[model samples]
Target: MASCIQIEGLLQSYIDEEASVSERLLIEEHLKSCGACSERLALNRATAATLFEVWREDQLREDLTRRVMAHLPEMPPPTSVSAALRRQVVVEGQRTRRWLGAAARLMPVFTPVILIILAGLLWVAWPSYYNMGGDEVIGMVTYCDANPDATHYSQGQARRLHVRNPIMPDDHFETGEEERLMLSLAGPSHITLLGQAAVQVRAPRAIVVTRGDVFFDVFRDNRRFQVHTPDGTITALGTSFQVSASKAGTVVTVVKGEVLVDNETSFVRLHENAQTAFTATERPTVRQGIDTSPYLRTARAVRPDPDAERRFLTQFIRNATHTPAPTEQVFVVNTERRHVNALLLKWMPDPYTSGHAGYTVYVSDSAMAPVFKTTISPEIFQDKQNNMVRLEMPNDMRRHDTHVLHITVMSDQSSGPVETTFTEVAAIGEAS
Candidate 1:
């Protein structure tokens, strides 16, 4: 090989500590004869020795630290038991240090994973917390008149108002005036709205406000299934009732079934005839009321008749199912002639049993009654067909002029009566 190539190979072999004894002797002889080769060999050896010395110094320092700590003045004497303990401590500490170093090295890789876990927890725990700037109120409206159908109203007018549905945030009513406003809603039962009251409504609970003046009835559809008033939170399951607040505190009346009232301190069960009132404050005084007789009485007196509802449903179903009049004038009623045509009537399917189908017919002026009578059924009808009585007006009917022709229909099961009225009078020269 060329001189330069030979020198390069020798230098690499020396660096790798791979030269055989004969090879090392040959390299030494070549170096002694060549000044350049000698200088290169010395330089390489010096570099390698400096590197090895640094590594040795680090090992010595670590050993010295361990030995010195083992011999510290504060250390207990090295009895056989103590020596064993010291060795164990040193081994465990070294293992712990290795684990700590591994953890530190992995910190950059794990940082995003830790942050993602934290973010997921926050999202699941409180969804609303993220929407800190969104408006919470579902709707707001002003009512100025007792009239329920007023489409428009002037501001500040003494009007009866309503808020149909609301999200009912804990911080909704901020003002005392807003709290005093009374609202009522009709669920399967009635509900009384409470003004700014601090109450806790628990789950699986229902509430009733027997009576105390407070305004606002949050309809049952509102998100507030439970109510928190000054007295306490009333929790319920599928209940319709009212809650009232006053100097006496808050009273819950159940319009329907039972509800459980649990203040942070105690719990109580309230039934239809029972009510529970809680006073405000941390150490609240709670009172129970019986004889919900007044509440029951009020509910029955004001509640809409369910029978009327049945009738309403039955009437519509009958009109749609039965055949309709073929012509625009298929059924006609002439008050002047005291005649009615195409009148329909229904009786019980079983003649022996008194079942009422209903009466739908074009009535003449004579058929209209000043006093709406409930008892007149088949006897008042003048026409009869196939064991079925046909409803009609009395031919002699007169005193009741400007007659009204009406079609009345009723349901089989106590559905209240529903009627459509039409005036019988015709314009001058108009056909009757």
Candidate 2:
């Protein structure tokens, strides 16, 4: 590695906006990892601000910066000069020569220029996803059910992400706590990203999961698909896996195929239904027979919630706690593995027949009106096998839309009348 002194001239050129693109890149990358260099840049900025204060009111920063920096008094071009010296002279001759000499002296070479250039070459040759900097479109957001929590930062703009947003090598992608995003890599494979995560596309096939969890569904054809994290690098092919990363460490779980993890000090290979984790300074510890279903079961297709989420969470909590619950939902929208001819609703209260009378069923594909309505008798509901009621979905409904079903459980109580509405949603072709 080149020392700080070796690249000092390159750094000065960067500040002056006189460096080549490659040189500026080298210094910028260096500044990211070197605190001393970063501090030097800060101090340089402070000095420049002070210098600007002394300039005339009419002098622009650019004008002052471009002003001749040579301290020597100007001298006239001479008719007689050695051929070697004359090489530095242009048509303007000695005046240009003196300026050239002064500029060279002002920007003295602290170290050999060749050495700084060699460092630049090494940086270019270094193996990293960021080395390939470009605006070339690498992928696109295939599915983004984004709320305000989701953002896609590209070039210099940050905005809400949407389907069809082109991804560049340097683009930054982040999601809010409950957001979900998907990226199609212009190939057969794609990436399903969970929320509260930050990601940067290093290459078309490589990504850096800076924080939070991410799922990769990669194809074997995209041979070198890899993910980088604070702790290590994970490489896989023809695999489905999840990576949870933080500054503390990383955890990798393999769903179907194998993955290789390197934590700087060592490497570990994890196969199907296996997992491994490690810190920055420790070797990965592998665990076998791990259940990967939880990671793979993330819901990618989401339908809009119609305020029934309160009931959903209530039911979810009751189920999680092993509380005694009814055999059937008050109302439900079920998923059938294939297209169905009939819409089924199973309603079973804790007691087989708790209602004082019958309940009204209302089904609709829109709020404007119910497509079907009927009074379901509690006696018939209980006597029937499974208390299952079937409704014919509207044939005119959109192929991709879902039907909403809600029922008001009516009972004549001491208060004269009592009613509780149980709501459910059903998708046309979803699996049970």
Best by lDDT: 2
- Per-model CA lDDT versus the true structure: 0.42, 0.62
lDDT for 379 (candidate 2): 54
lDDT of 1 by residue, 87-193 (tens): 89899999999999999999999998999999999888763413443233322221111223332122323222333322222222211322322221112122222
lDDT tens digits, residue span 199-305, model 2: 88867678989888788877544367889998999999867788998777899998777899998799999998999988777999999999875675562232212
Clashes of each: 26, 2
TM value for model 1? 0.26
Kindly provide the TM-score of model 2 when superposed on the true structure, using C-alpha atoms.
Answer: 0.39
True-structure lDDT of candidate 2: 0.62
Error of 1 at 207 (Å): 10
Q: Which ten-residue region of model 1 has the weakest summed lDDT?
A: 347-356
lDDT of 2 at 87: 76
Angstrom error at residue 5, model 2: 99
